[model samples]
Target chain A: MSVTAAKGFTAAGVAAGIKESGGEDLALVVNNGPRRAAAGVFTANRVKAAPVLWSQQVLKGGAVSAVVLNSGGANACTGPLGFQDTHATAEQAASVLGLGAGEIAVCSTGLIGTRLPMDRLLPGVEEAAGRLSEYGGEKAALAIKTTDTVHKTAVVRGSGGWTVGGMAKGAGMLAPSLATMLVVLTTDADLDSAALDGALRDASRTTFERIDSDGCLSTNDTVLLLASGAAEVVPDGTEFTEAVRTVCDDLAQQLIRDAEGASKDIRIEVRNAASEDDAVEVGRSVARSNLLKCAVHGEDPNWGRVLSAIGTTGAVFEPDRLGVAVNGVWVCRNGSVGEDRDKVDMRYREVGITVDLAAGPESAVIWTNDLTADYVHENSAYSS
Target chain B: MSVTAAKGFTAAGVAAGIKESGGEDLALVVNNGPRRAAAGVFTANRVKAAPVLWSQQVLKGGAVSAVVLNSGGANACTGPLGFQDTHATAEQAASVLGLGAGEIAVCSTGLIGTRLPMDRLLPGVEEAAGRLSEYGGEKAALAIKTTDTVHKTAVVRGSGGWTVGGMAKGAGMLAPSLATMLVVLTTDADLDSAALDGALRDASRTTFERIDSDGCLSTNDTVLLLASGAAEVVPDGTEFTEAVRTVCDDLAQQLIRDAEGASKDIRIEVRNAASEDDAVEVGRSVARSNLLKCAVHGEDPNWGRVLSAIGTTGAVFEPDRLGVAVNGVWVCRNGSVGEDRDKVDMRYREVGITVDLAAGPESAVIWTNDLTADYVHENSAYSS
Candidate 1:
């Protein structure tokens, strides 16, 4: 059960003929709750899609009764008509669910600069409203996929009998500030909008904002968390925030695992930084180094590229005091050759790179994928 | 004629057995100058190669009498031993040429974190010194090839019988601050060290500092300008600066054309920005976008990706007022659909992407290459 794993939430997926292959292309989730509290995070990209713009406005009220997401058309760069299309989508969903249009949020993904098939999409929304069920979370997850190989879902149980669960779909254009993905989360905790918003922003900062697959930010990234008071348990604030963070971290890992054309999932952990910001800055610089990614793909344990990447950042570290390890082998120590590189085995799908700044106690982790020929082929052939 | 195209310069290249393939890997350029005046630029990367460290110190005196460059071993991240190796190489060159070791500069490019084969390299320096000739500039250029397919050289002649000539070698790890390459420029203009320094910095700012091939900076980039007053022509400062800029620009273009595994040379021009820094920031962001580069490789005028790249930068521009064009076709105008993408033809080896921020009148250009499977293959297979 992903979003529907929590009480007072119903979801459905339907084929709207938006995708040429006639696959499920539309998903709907409704919060039938005594309390309609929600929070959201959007793409930092200024060139947002129409749906993103509409949802940002709708979310300002801190209340959302329903969400309508679709695949096969991003509805971006389509001029003012695109905004009208998103508004119409929300209106249709609101009418079918007997809610105000201001209480609905809409999201779209796929090829950008295209208009949605409004004729097919409007009818599909009504059909999806009729078929909404508590067990339809998996179907909703499947419908939101563009290039994802599989649906991703996660759930966490709070000690006070509250539940937090979510689903995510992303395969490319994945980078930080936010990955190019759509996520809908549902919780049965008795909380106010202020609490939900605080928890969500905190959780997203440490989890979703740390995974960078290709370093390409998109115009359509959206994440929403909706709370319903069906479970009368008022969870402790710390417990509720931890649950949200756990679920988000799980889904973020799933996104990285399913990143397009990836051969290996690399974990870059920077330690002994002067500050958390410095640690994150160093991690991001290493994460975005295409040369280092390619070296990981080749399993060469080329630590010099790692140093070259770290050198580009303004992080506090002495060049001669730096240390690097690949697969638990200290291949470079004090910024020089240390152990035998042949000792590091990189035959597995997961690789670990550790960088020691030898400056302080702070640390940070950034997840990324190895660059492969298949990545180039997939991206070059598929126009976004 | 490259470095030796100008008067008062002699150069030679010889096989040092440092390269496993046994190609010419050692080069020497000597200034037979009535006045020894020079200026140099090295990589901004903090984890610099040993030779870069040595050369930076030599250039501080502004009187480099000779330069020794080698391929097949970068001698970087090799700790104190690497520094000693560079010192030994310079000492050998100085001893052979009957000059102080402080007057000699050194440069190396190849695999990082490896020690040079000093036994063969020291002997090769002696042989190169014995064979130094005014016509050996071409041979010197040929010696510095790591992955470059050809030697790059350019010359600009002044009206007053003075000339500026240079040679450059780089094929990968090219990015701003400087490309990962070794360059030696010689001029016959009667100028002092301070004048040469000012001209070299001014020229490099707009030339080598603008091209970003793969967004990877190297630890061994070095560019040097040596002035010899043997021709006794005190040329106008403006003319001399222009000549130096012309030669640097030509060599920069050659570096882009020969970028490893590149199928297209892309010129990204950002116009109508609030300031020149904004223009450059916007252009560099677009140039480094893997998605945009892949789209260019597929010959798809995916202007949405271009807009997405621009959105990630802090450059001043309204989302709806931004514009993008590919090869003269305005695929996106006013941040929406403009001309038909099919009208744009990318069937040639050179492509131009223009971004209009509509913020101000400043502009900048950044050169880059498209991402391709061949690029991934070449990088993954190469250990460095």
Candidate 2:
């Protein structure tokens, strides 16, 4: 059974008047498994949300029974008053669930620098705590969404019995170099916080951090992993690690797929760099490229933009050592345009380009969405 | 007497096979006067083009009697052979015009890494020489077009009866720090190359470098300025320099106005920054922001994108000391969302945002285009 499919986990979503449209604004989830072990990953953005700070420190103690999340008002840069509001919301949830305030985690999304509507939020959290159930994953996922088009959830079952479930929410303000890794992971296997942190960091590098669409990291990013140890035995070694990665990857892809007004997802891979660090820098250079992203949106395989991007990195390399391929065709070789580039088909819903530095074998890949008009339309309508 | 209305300058345009549509593909300009003094600025992109390398060395002599330019091919990253082709193109232009090869300069625009169609180009250069005219400033501008929807040209009169007329072409490959700065400055003023270079660098810093919209520097970038000394009077002080900057600023603004699919022109001014460098960095940081650009496109007034972008810079400042305003309205003060944010309006076609670091009097201003779908459609179509 999936971790979310385990016993006594309930969720509820309701409009708490944070967003102007008054859409789904808050979510609540409680773990009543008879065993509680929780861990989390927060945003690397130095300017973090009050909720992120609250959740991160709470997860340090290793036991969490509930998570209260809200979309539409990211309680960030709201100073001391914001933190006090977060504390009040968590306390209200604790009072309703017959648990201490320290046993809860809080997550907030939406416009930054805004304080929470404490009166509405407190009641919302209390209602969420009262509605906890075994099949509330869907509601919780829906409630945590901001500009995301759809709810993001992933469930995987391990051999011998343990299952891991996770939910994520983010659309824009994502460059997550661990953008908003805001995640709630549930599992029936018991892993200590140290083990969870190790797994989380590894899983995130290849997944969340790969969504480099806009290069803007969010203020509220939290990823929490809770284990009940209800399973007899968890899967072994790379097998278990692979499962965790799979869950993380799925959630990450959804984040990109649902990126604000995104028309296409472009994956850029740089191979043969001098080192992995150089490779990551090269990949990131291209990923953060507005020109490259715009070209991808227009279906133009402008390899020149690709080469220009790589040239900006401080990494050392000969210009001639660079080679570029678009959608599997060698578009450039030895730093010059390759032969028969006209025959290459760059039109695709999903485009992949590879830059071969020819400096070494170390490589990395980054995932991002094309910059489009809709991206602007989706973002400019109001001050969120 | 504007530079375009100046004497001793003749221009011509022709449809070489460079552009697929067979529009005006080649442009030529000549100084009838006996003396020719010129200076140039090439792309700082590490992957320099063959023409850039050729021109940088040629400028040591500080003179160019004529220039040959083509649209549709940047001729960048073409390696050793590309350099040979550039020299050949120059020799051909010289041969056709009965002049020395060293007297002519070459500029290319279009896709990078592709070789020029020398067979068609050689004959086209000869054909263009036969078509030169004093009214050729317009023709020269058109001959240098690329993905840009319009041609960019500017002319200004310097002191002492000297005229400084210039033409520039660039759009898609613009960003801060620099982009395609292909310019031809013609004047009767007699100035040394050293003086010209110093003035050009200063003008560029305040203008071209401030218009970084896409954040990607191009390989084909070249700003070629020539002074014929036909009027034979060099203005003392910064008069000539100011004229150059005025033209550069006008052209730079035009490029931003025509940035691909751009729906709005945004001016981000950073005031009260700790230092000029810090102010410029902060301005550039805000200008390079995709989420913020998108928000500006949507007219969303999402100040969170603003504060988040500021936090990414190395510029030291307390978050609480930051103040952000939209269209003169302080939406955020002391790091928190201000009460008057809801009263602000973002519906106008032109938008201005101000960020005060509350540190010092130093300030900087950056001009950028909003991220739009047309930008996507234009870049994605096929320059691969």
Candidate 3:
């Protein structure tokens, strides 16, 4: 169960002929709600896609009835025509659902700088709307995939009589500020737009915002949440927030595991930083180093690359006070060789690297993938 | 005629059995000058190698009698022992050259966190010193290779009967803050320490400082310039600076062309930026984008990735005012599609990408390499 796992939600997936591969490329999610509260978080990238621009305007009033996502054309850098195309998609969906266009949200992902196939997309929306079902969450999740090899969905059951579920689509261009990714979350709990917004922002800060797969941001990144209140149970803010965080965390890990061409998943934990920001900065610096990533892929246990990456950052730390560990072996201590590097085993799909700054107590964990030949081959094999 | 093209400079290359491959891995260059003025630039990375630390201390007096470089191991993160190894190497060179240890500099490159074999290294230093000759520049350049396929050298002639020559060694870990590189430049012009420092810094700012090969800064990067007044030519500062820049530019281009496993060399020029710094920032951002680099390698005119990279930077530019051109074809104009992407050609080793922010007249260019499968294979094939 994905978005439709929660009560008061209906979803559908349709083959829109948008993807040249003849796969399902259009998804529709609707909230049959007693309360139509909504929240959204978009990419911070200035060069945003048309759907993101339209959704931002639709979310201004914090009320949403439906969401439409397409996976074949991003409708980005297409000038005014792209914006008009997004408007038309929302209008067509709204007309089919007998609702206002302003209450519908839109998201698009695929190759940028292209106009969507409007003729096929508009009719596909009506077909999807007619076929919408409460058990169509898996289809909806599969339809919004570009380069993803598998569909990703997460669900969390609350202690109260409410539930939260989400579906995300991304395979490449994954980084910290988000990439060419799109996510839709649904809840059957009594909540307001402000409450959803606060919880989503807090959940996303540590979950979706800490994965750096390739250090490439995207112009079409969006996450939206809709609350229907069909369960008639108002959850405590903390309880509901924790559920949302859990789903996001699950989805984030799924993205990293399925990142394009990755051979190993690396979890970098930077502890003893002067502050949270410093910890995050240092962690990202190490996570984005191509040398370190390649070494990890080769299982070389090259901790020197880690120190070099950290040295490039502006974090407050003494050079001689730095420490590093691979797996569980402390390879470097006090910025010097500590243990035998040959003893550190790296023959696993998952690698753990810990950096100690010995400056303060703040810490951060950043997930990244190793750079490999297959990654280069897969990325260069296609333009998306 | 690398460093020895300049008068009053002698160099030698020797094998110390330091490299397991048994290649020449030790090099020495001495400036038997009427003037012992010197200036050097090192890596900005805080976690410096022991050789870098030793050289920094030696250069404070603005007089260097000789330089010793090794290619088998980088004495970095080895604690006090590493520093002592660097000192011992310098002292051995000074003894052979009949000079004070304080006047000798050291540079090391290759695998970090490894100590040099002093038993072999010290004897090799004396052998190199005994064989030092004005015609040994080529051998000296060859001896410094790590993963480099060929030796790199440049020579610039002065109108006043003086010359400048240099050698550089780097293959992988080639980033903007300098690669795991070592360079020794010698000039026969009449110049003091202050003038040499001013000229070297000015020349390097726009040349060596603008190339980002893999976005991995090194802990062992050093560039040294030694001046000898044996030619008796008091050339103008601008002339000397221009000559130094030409040699640096030549060497920098060679480094990019011979970078490890690279298939395409990309030159990103950001134009119409709000400021020169803004232009540089945007250019570097585009250069460092792995997705864009991969797209270029695949010969795809993916300007959307270009805009995404620019969006991640803090450069001041309106979304609609951005423009992008590849190989002189304006593929993206006014933040939308302009020319047919099919018209853009990428069947060449050198690719030119120009990003126009339309914010101001300032512009900057950053040289980079395309991400390729060969790069991953070459980098992961060896630990260093």
Tens digits of per-residue lDDT, candidate 2, A302-381, equal 78788888888877678987888988888888888785666667566788889998888788888888877777666666
Q: Which lDDT tens digits does candidate 2 get at residues B311-377? A: 7788867887788999988888888777576676878867898999998889988888777766666
Instruction: Residues A1-384, candidate 3: write the lDDT tens digits.
Output: 999989999999999899998899999999999988999988878888999999999999789999999999899999999999999999999999999999999999988899999999999999999999999999999999987889999999998689999999995323443237788999999999999999999998888888888888888888899999998999999999999999988998988898888889999999999999999999999989988888898888889989999999999998889999999899999988888988899989999999999999899999999998877776666773
Model 3, A145: alpha-carbon shift in Å?
0.7
Q: In lDDT terms, how accurate is model 3?
A: 0.90
Best by DockQ: 3
- The per-candidate TM-score of the B chain, in the order shown, comes to 0.98, 0.95, 0.98
TM-score of chain A of each: 0.98, 0.94, 0.98
TM-score of each: 0.98, 0.91, 0.98
CAPRI quality of model 1:
medium
Backbone clashes in candidate 1 total 0
Reference-based lDDT, each prediction: 0.90, 0.77, 0.90
Model 2 chain A lDDT-worst window of ten: A172-181
- Model 3: pairs clashing at backbone N, Cα or C within 3 Å: none
Model 1 per-residue lDDT tens digits across residues A1-52: 8999999999999999999989999999999998999999998898999999
lDDT of 2: 0.77
| Chain A vs. native, model 1, TM-score | 0.98
